[model samples]
Target: MQSPPATAPVAAPPERGTSPRRAAPRLVGWLAAAWLGPLLAYALGVAGVLPVVVLGLTAALLRGGRTLLDRLVLAGALLLGAACAAGLLFSAWPWGLHPVPVAGTALTVLLGVAAATGRRPRLPRPVPADLLPVAAALVAAGALAWPYLRAGDLAGRLAYAMTGEDNSRHLATVEGIRAVGGYLFADPSAAARIAPEGMVWYPQGFHLTAALLDGFLRSSTAPAGPASTLDHYLGWSLGAWGLLVLAVTWAANRLAGPRLDLPRAAALTGALTAACLGSELARFVVYGYPGESLGLAATVLLVALACRPVARTGTQLAVVGALCVAVGFAYLMFLPVVAVLVLAWLVRDRRRLRRRPAVLAVVALLTAVLAPLPAVAGLLRTDQVDNVATGGGVFPRYDAFLALAGLVAAGLFAGGLRLPVWRRYAGALAAALAFAGGFLVYFRALGTDPRYYYGKTLHLLLAVLLVGAGAVTLLLPAPGRAAQSRPRAARPHDRAAESRPRAARPHDRAAESRPRAARLRWRTPRPARALAAAAVVLACAGLAGLPRGTGIFAQPFDGRTMTWAAAWWSGTQARPGPAELAVRALAQAPAEAGVVTVVVSDRRREGYLATLFVATLQGTHGASGPAVYRLPLSEPARSAALVERVPGRIRFVAADPAAAGIVEALLAAHPDLAGRVTLQRLR
Candidate 1:
């Protein structure tokens, strides 16, 4: 709950309002600021609900005279919680879960009933000064996010969101959601029911986004294909990630305690964004881990919300409960993350918080812990795998950026030891880093083949360290001598002195006659100097360690991480290659509610073609439920005896020409498939 410093320096009043000639840049600036909200909505796929939720929060925020940090916390938590909860609820309703409906109805009733009981909404106080810096940051964040898409596939290219590491599953899951299309989360829930781990029950807000976006594209005149997916991503998801970075930056700096001014807060954001790409988590994006991205954003948001003054009212409890369900439904790990935040919050202010809002705080904590019970139960039902501890590589290969980032962050922290940040947040910062280390140790101790566990900690550690550094750097000493204190001759009224006939004030003629540069040599203004340094820091913070090479920012998406992905746990197993895209001929062939036995004889890629076949079929419309049987193509791969044992009621065959001939010879020999089997040759 550390508050960011208030917008520190107010702008000096201008002599007059701007004229029309200078208005275009200001308009463009406002337009950029306007894009921030939609960027987050598109990223989370809450466009349908986000605007409404934003209106509600805005109304409440104005009534309460909320700070920009507080407003963002409220808006982010409220929107994410509502959208994800609705998704989970609709998806779960088919299984007879009343969580969403019950909660929604109860909340609606409470809103009305409590209207008469709660305090009347207040008229908001106008505070333009406080809002200006926040406005600038919003536009700045949008500006930073803008360039990433300019270099994307939007111009002309064929691709799916196949760039990220786990995007195969992530993108497939999104299509799977569409493939099982129904009322909102209901279809998504059905998907979850089929394969909770792979497709269904994970954090699905991003999927919901996909659903919303894809549904729109489906209805539009836009071309349909993988290239369309690229368009959607470039137009939306890419910018959304940028917005997420900005939102997290705001939350992190705000969490550092409220004295953070806009420039420093922005510095912290830049620093944090730079580290995000370099962190082990970058692997998730490189690998296409959709859930991890959403979960991480939620974690930052939950932490941000913990800073909101804890309240004990039916309405507060209801909202918190909704958010808990959303977090669990979106990504269950975040429940624990929020739980830790709750524990930390309670622990930090135990003496002070014990008095008034104790019961309410407990309610909030219990809500967070218990909200994900259904998901936890589902996870428990799955068989567990215990991996014996084997160590992982330190700093990881190809992540030299991580090493550079760590050095920079450490230096920043160390360099600022003389600053006040150490006095207030040194312990909290240490605790966060320690907690991150502890996570690594605990997981590495369990040695459960860490997919993303250790790296998540690195992300957290980097962000915390950057916030500490930014706070110190931004908290520069107050301007010296010449006085933000209004020194004599340079006062606002001093301009009026020119009209007075004070005999040219000694050397005024010489000063006026001097070269423009020479006359102003000693002016050395503090504001420009401070702001110029801050601007350079901001640029470096935003651009440093970003993904480099041909990408929009520094990070190139799919190609850079392919090397690491090849070594990933699932890289070798049933991993699809180019064959999936090559096998479109079969999609046009007749299919039934049965299994497809694929025999791919491309010796250059053996098991890889089979993997492609399975993933491609799973992605086929109305085939999400299909059972895939992989048959490696060889003389021995086809067995006439095995043809009779195929389990599907209606069988289909899809294979390369040689494999098709092999399958045809086998079927000719046995004739067991009868009319129930269909065979289509793949190109």
Candidate 2:
């Protein structure tokens, strides 16, 4: 295979010429490739034509004598086409019986290995100076927007976890493990029966971390409940925010070309796309569902690490192990995807592997061993084996539109089809196939009313596709040189003497050199600026009406609200001591005299939990027993009625005494209780 020489800057088309538009046929062809490529591949696989299609594409490309990059791209496109064809062709066949495509994939891997044998060029390493700020902005966006979107039912979930409901379950398992003093796996059947909803299917690693954190916090502060409410927010924030940063940064780096520019815009757009795709996953976290978030986060990290071209052996092993653990914990379907990625990586760098095959082998072994731990535990302890088998019949419909849109978005953003690297092509192809297969599996697992499954899977696939596309688009093209006022096709003899090649022969000489900074400064004149403005306006209009007429801030209490709430909560109770003590004092009060009415401005459950923790710590019977009326100041008559009915039973009402009518009403309604009420300012 003849590799293409290092890319030389191409002269820009003359300014007077009209810009070339994609031919209508070419547009249709590309659209068809996007939409029907998988389907055609699946059909061929079913008809036993996969081999023919692969060989034909490969032969055709080879015959064309295209550059090595083109050949590599063609190879990947063929493999992807084959996988999709096989999927469709064997749609009715069981996964096990579909052998042709599997064999074809194996053959593709072998070819990839053979092709990578020669000397490979090294790309520049990405610098933190270029990456960190973009990453930070993406993380900030997630943090800022998370709180508002996390309110209502979502807040209740976090509140439940914070109060220790979810953590308590995990802790019980952990305590059991500690009691046994080894890796004492719980009974899967019993575990499943009592396992917190949404977590029953997940592995233990992620939950184990949460449990450990809860234990430490409890030991230190002895919060009233089994879990800390803060744990929910912290867990969600960390997992979601972390994934967003990693994914968006990866995408931005891919899009920003070797030098990062104002990558914030691309990062933000990519983040939004990812958020939309993973919205359900986000909701799962807010509802105190850590299992899904944990699994999803693990998957994201695993994919990110796998995407790295050069990694330490140890890092690769660690990533493999983590991925295995994540798959074991989250979903079994992930195993095949992980397998394909690792195999592809190995194929791409077989020479490196020959030097240290043991590392890869060890990673494979650990992955196999550790990944099944949770599944084994389930098998031994319960009927999960049968459950998994029975559940196999459930299949969700794959949203063709979303998948197409995601592919287009990914293509546009990452320039996946445009990249010259074989590894990049392989990675993109693998991702697309994995997504399609995973969706098929997911659909199968949904059984009935697969629409919900479609919704969930559509978001996930779109995120993956868009991120992939965006990264590809950014990295493929090198920066353009600054435009000069020179006339087109000027005679080489008229050019400056220094601009001429020093070498005697054309092939032996390098192109005219320009500083990287100078090259980056090149801007297309007036027409380009006008086009960019038009594009921006169109983009803004499109965003304003995205998801079928929804506004940009259409979702209720989106990221903005969540961020504000989280910030406010963080600021008000920077330390939990005062709030903890206050709740304890209230909890110590007598119950029959009625409850301790703690009036707080925020209606979130975290606030109530904080109040309850303080009351419980103070040895207040009302805090633990009953009659604990933790009313929001927003509710007036209810607060008044509780005080009126309880009278002397109301020992203390915690409130911001300086507040307006609500405080005045409380003071007037229960003057005796008001004297006993402690005015504690969070600040």
Candidate 3:
């Protein structure tokens, strides 16, 4: 079962490259193997969205005719992309149009079409060796997730044990989508009276998918949690992130190539996993950036899809495009990473790439480039420029880590010049430039947010390590017919052995002692390669623990951090967090369904719940955005027209003067409701 080594001047025999006819079987096999871990982990987490991912992969297989590895990586990308795209499309519909049922319906239609095409792929039989890599990834993923999978319901882990303001906000978004049936582009709470005129198009891949999964789990026959919102948030986090470990391992496999014997592949897998499980990922989890984390993993798979040999078919190109769209939907901020890889791959095969997949690559780049402009990037919703701080700090604390990584990446590029797989390092070089450029230009122009660059460079660092692994695998000699099959002609001295003097004889001991030009550098031995792989894993594993343990920031997760974690939506409000308070406040609102406005002037950000989801959640109307949480209702008419839009019986949920001002504004706006407005205080 030995195959040709990936490196060296040896070319694979014509028969070795699997033809299009064999593609269907391999494609099916690859998809099964690649998705095995994710399927097992997310079996129930996202049953609703699963068919969408599967159907998308099926569509990609229909476009077949690639090697097993290519099909495997490409299928993963297509599956992820399909699910996200479906979620985005459905999220645009009304609340009744939940992504789960909508995507399921679409999947059914796509599958029927696929069946009719007669190009249906068969799942390939995976060998024991193939299962090893899958096991490795799943194991690594389980290790990283050990802390989160504690004994208890998800709400306990997420509510009291969780940290960060984003997760709750993400939950709010998911609930909002679930409530609205689609991304109405307005606040989710605007269902009551009138949501603001602002049309939101935020990518709903992560949020919508999570919502679908949460709904699936809730309706399941398992024990129920205390509240459905926490369950939904937990489902979203796991649905997007549960497969991260497998995704990274698959990317490492793509970078290493299938020609690797089990040992080398295993070694590369370790190094790749080490590089991938960085501290930033932990921070993303703890900090609550589900979208960013999901994007990071998706883009890794995207790179694997894009880095294929030219001769790519239209179907393959379509799969790549779908994956790219998903990556965009998940985290437009990291779109450039995938775009750059596609461009780099195209440049490498200037001959074939120029004709094939070139249009696909261009379209991908255009999608990424146009995402920032409000005119066409509306699909991104709140991720637009309006979401960024117009003014704030310049350099985030992580800049130091990014800079250090840049230098190391540069040194790697410089030092690994002679390796056969040096070209693979293009990903690293491009990512480095992108990272530096974003820091110097984009963040500076848009104001620095800690979360902006935090998850961006994780893939970049892993990319650098994968490139290094490629170089090692290529430079190291592999004993195969292709690698050493070609025998060199006899040397001149050997042909004229009888004519040589006694001292010049080939067998002379002095000849062995003499220096020779061919021995300039010692070829990296197999043991050394194994050692290097081990070292890479150890270092990366140590760093991987950094964010969760004592990271570069060394910021201990003190009581304040716990408060932030438990705070979820409320940062540092009252005991149970602001989301709890806001939900409680809304629960107390008049059940008659009048406009019930909730306000939080402090950093709690709890008020967005009122503006976003409280309306749909509580069966009332909420007409305030998070910004208005701090808005002083000094001018009655202005305040009334601005936030407190209810004509009568405005339910005020803040104790500050701003809350008072809103009541005054409500009274002034609707003179008939002078005594209807009421205030409630939360302890």
Which candidate comes out best when scored by TM-score? 3
Q: What is the alpha-carbon lDDT for the whole of candidate 1?
A: 0.43
The digit string of per-residue lDDT tens for model 3 on 1-683 reads 66333321122332325566786686566545444533453454554445446555563434332233334545656656655555545645553443344444554555444544534443332333455456655664554444456524432343332345455456556655556655545344443232232324555567656655555454331323225555456545744554565566665554444235455666667655554444344445555667866776676666554543323344546665666776676677666566677667656655644565566666556445433332245744454555443433333335535644554455335433432223455554567556655555665564555344433554455444444444354444342332222322211111122244655432222223545433223346667756865776666555544323332323323343321122222223322344454555544553454444655433333454333344433323224333233454333433455444444555566635665655655557567655766666644
lDDT, candidate 2, residue 284?
41
Candidate 1 TM-score versus the reference: 0.62
Q: Rate the local accuracy (lDDT) of all candidates.
A: 0.43, 0.39, 0.48
Q: Estimate each model's TM-score.
A: 0.62, 0.46, 0.63
Compared with the true structure, the alpha-carbon lDDT of candidate 2 equals: 0.39
Error at 452, model 1, angstroms:
4.6
Q: Which parts of model 2 have CA positions greater than 4 angstroms off?
A: 1-202, 213-241, 251-281, 311-314, 330-333, 383-415, 418-447, 451-460, 471-477, 481-521, 524-683
Q: Where does candidate 1 have its weakest 10-residue lDDT segment?
A: 7-16
Which candidate comes out best when scored by lDDT? 3
**Candidate 3's C-alpha lDDT?**
0.48
Residue 96 of model 2, lDDT score: 20
RMSD, every candidate, angstroms: 12.9, 20.7, 10.5
Better of 1 and 3 by lDDT: 3
